[model samples]
Target: MPVDNHDHDHQDRFEERLGEALHQAGGAYETDRRALVAAGETRGHRLLLRRRAAVVAGVASVALVGLGGALLVPGGDDGRQSVATGAKTPVASATPKASYTGDELIGILEKLLPRGEFSSPQARGTDDRLPPYAQVVHDDGKGKAAVAVGFDRVLPGSEQARQTVECPDKVLTPYDGCVVSRLSDGSALRIFQGYEYPDRRADTKLWTADLVTPKGQHVSVSEWNAAAEKGAPVSRAEPPLSPARLRTLATAAAWLGVVDAIPVDPKAPTAAPAQPSGIDGGAIASTLVSLLPKGVKVVARSGPDSGYAYVVVDDGKGRSLVQINVQPNMSDVEDQLFGAGAETLADGTKVVTHKEPGEKGGAGVVMWTADTLRTDGFRVVVSAFNSGSQETAATRDAPALTTKQLRAIALSAKWRGLG
Candidate 1:
């Protein structure tokens, strides 16, 4: 895909853990359900809980294979229920001692959803993984859609919690609408209406609600106009749930109980990863603007996001989106990123250039990139897209900045002082 190895490394870590969980549970289930579980693992990469620096999907659903079996039964007005089959229990914690069966979690989801005929139900329970979730193909007489809910825990005042509610930049993620608010219980909620494909290659709509409580309980609900997140035809005008309904489903008391059931990871890190002390995004953007070829004017720019920045520029033709990622101590992945055909500067710097189609799926979009690494393991990668936003169709034949201009920007000496 010609993506940065550093970002791919983060995604790999998450996928590896999820793969282990699925492999352990695949044997006990029917083949169809097992496939459903695998689909969820693949879709999990798009969840909003991931690091923004990685450029994953802005919002999506996650499904995981539950570890053990459970007996299903019809339940009250909400939905069906299931009782765990085994006696294996999780370690004790102060949050809540209750455990849930995969079927029980699915039952809870049905209860929260508007009256609908649900099929292909799949889920993971508190006894299975850190973040448990449920998915169902639902039809409310309008059309078939896929609805899901996932639960996890984040530190109350942590960066993850904050980012969970923050709206992603429109330049990076194209969306119809988004709002973040504080609930009565001091929880934060974000309701997002966006496309299933950021580039809008398909008309499928994706709507999501994310709620983070003061006690670290995180619940997210997502629905798609189609029966699947990817590779499915659009089956309706919109997702089955409205913004209000998504809010109600995600904040249900039943979900709080499920989130409470998740076991605490004794080895989990207590804080966010530390970054280079002075690596400021604002400085990076300013430096990029300063290095631009004459006559190229900056139109819009990103805020001071630490270690990442972008600018939309025009040179009398069309707007182009340029972005940079500056990182320190990345020599560990040097071999993986700069393999053969990479150039070496006299000062022990490795440089590589790429001309390829855009990765974000924007139609007719192209991307030009320059990646450089210094002897101190400092890395700077800059990319210029033919379109001002990756989620939109291309507006020009080429980016405002040529590959040589991009290379000059990446190799500029100014980035050294910023970090």
Candidate 2:
């Protein structure tokens, strides 16, 4: 329901670093577009699968890798692209596009920033496999902080573009302040002030300015109160850049040139994917609320996120977080999920119940779950937490809903009709 940062397993860390390194490699190199596009699409598919695992399995650390996209950075002193991973060598492209090296982009960022000491600079050029970005630890005579800028493209007037600037729901992403404005040139800009950890488990602050132009150019500027985004103590009261400065930096005209240099992925879907369709998030949320037993009222809820929904309800005792995920064509994994101890209904639906410690690392927190898979390969799982948020300490001894209630909710006829 919400995002949190915690220690990840060794494999998770390896994958995260690999993804970051691959994205940060940049240079003026060329390769067969067809092959690269195929690889990128393959990566995109894997990314989606990982995201689903994060949501369903509560592997919060895996979700921190990043939103799927390439990262572009600056070149070296000799103006040659720097490779972070040294995994791929670019041959030659039959068609070459005008682009900026990582060094050039970093130079622009240095010139745009206020007088300050910069260190730990990292970049990827426009011609890199991933989109370009420039990052550095900047000290503006105050405390050290990390500042970064990145470029990408979105379909104009599409849901992606709109969501790029839309403020997240407070229930899902607790933040200090968020502002969305339209620039005179018809671009959308969002200035967000939030914590690096949504639950305020840590004091690190993250502020960002996201801009999307009418023609689909996207520029994002982000800064942190600490020298690094994670695992660093707070270095200052706030990030080095103010909201106005962040807006100015992200909207800089120089970034537009960088964005224009990025080539459109030939294999990228022009429209949304066709599969995995069912009830909308709004319908799911409405259905969840309706299923709640008496004496409980919804105190907070999530936006319609399609196939997943959550609500925090308060009984006279305390607040609890309940969430559900509905999936179609899940029979392939049914054997792994529904084991020998699982109960089988007369109609052939498999049901399993689990009582376990919360995966989010909240002290004293517990999770009660009800998992079910229909004969048609449709799966519905319902879980309830003893705390209002999985990241916080438990407020009560148990979740407001009993395991039986969760099972009933998961097996409800209402869910079958929706799917």
Candidate 3:
């Protein structure tokens, strides 16, 4: 979404002040400009990624977070760290998601292949504008498989988004830039890549290799380069298990939990106003603020774009932290998608990312960009972490959080309340 100055004096003032505040922050100017360049270059990246050239990583918000399924996490390098307990996730033997049907998958194939051929097309690397032949193959790791036959002027991502809309029976998860189907059989198939932000000129062919635990959770190894030529199809080694942990993977991606966790937008009017959760939006912000260094004075705000009343508390010093987001009881997948990080791992997934050098910050840092979703009646919680400690702190806490923590943060967090 692009920001426009609509001549609202209040908005203009806020923008003016915000800009001045950013300038005072110094490095934030660079961060903001770099973020802008990354955002604008999205479409251009897809245009240039087809040369099979080596790609480089750059700045991006919400880059993939890895839920590493390591066989044995080293404990303090002394070979004795007790691994942290597994985070709870949903699991069940999926028959294949009922949301999509076989016919829909075939339709997607028609667009990818030439006459939707079963075998590789006669032309190799020629500019004939070939269509890919899609198939629901086996052995693709997440329990099912899918393959696209060719790429003669075919950009996987542009096509993947189109296919997702038509194929409702499947779970469409985007990895790196390519897309994949989270099949009911507990497998994922690579489709194509989408546009990556920050530097479209950096690279294109996003690749993903998927693995689904017997318990049904998935893990993908995604790379944004020539996915096929430079890598193995899917390489994996089983992780030692806890039977209980395995059972959790079979369930859905916990979209329901995420829905249950979002706090209602304070700005949305009740027509029939939605029921208020026990906790209000302020708690989210307050909780967010509370998590920071003591004595850090913060200016707070509440908004609806994020599907959760979000609180961004900025310490008067150049550093900041996004503390809380509260959502009311709602049962929509779209909100869940927008509101929370992935609760379960999926196939064809990768953990690729980009960040500023010397900055070391990574995914999940709240930003002003999440604000635009509000116009559509969404709620957003935006937070900026203080420099240095920001990324180190968030990544460490992300996977350790339980469903209980997620819900409590939304339902019980207290904020500086004026909604």
Alpha-carbon lDDT of model 2: 0.65
Error of 3 at 416 (Å): 11
**TM-score of model 3 (CA atoms):** 0.23
Compose the digit string of candidate 3's lDDT tens values, residues 341-379.
Answer: 423224311111123221223344322222112222222
Residue 174 of model 2, lDDT score = 52
**Model 1, CA-based lDDT:** 0.65
Residue-by-residue lDDT tens digits, candidate 1, 1-419? 11122234322332222212222334222223112111111111221112332222222111111111111222222111222222112222344547888888888788878897998776767886435777788999998998878777766554455566556666777777765555544566667787766778789787877776667677777789988766679889999988767877776767777877877777665663443353677888888889999998898887666666788999899999987777777676577567788999899999988887776668999888888889998888888889998768999999999889888988988888887
TM-score of 2: 0.74
lDDT of 2 at 201: 77
Model 1 TM-score, all chains together:
0.75
Off by over 4 Å in 1: 1-97, 270-278
**TM-scores, each model vs. reference:** 0.75, 0.74, 0.23
Which pairs clash inside model 1? 78-111
Compared with the true structure, what per-residue lDDT tens digits does model 2 show for residues 256-276?
A: 878778876776556533334
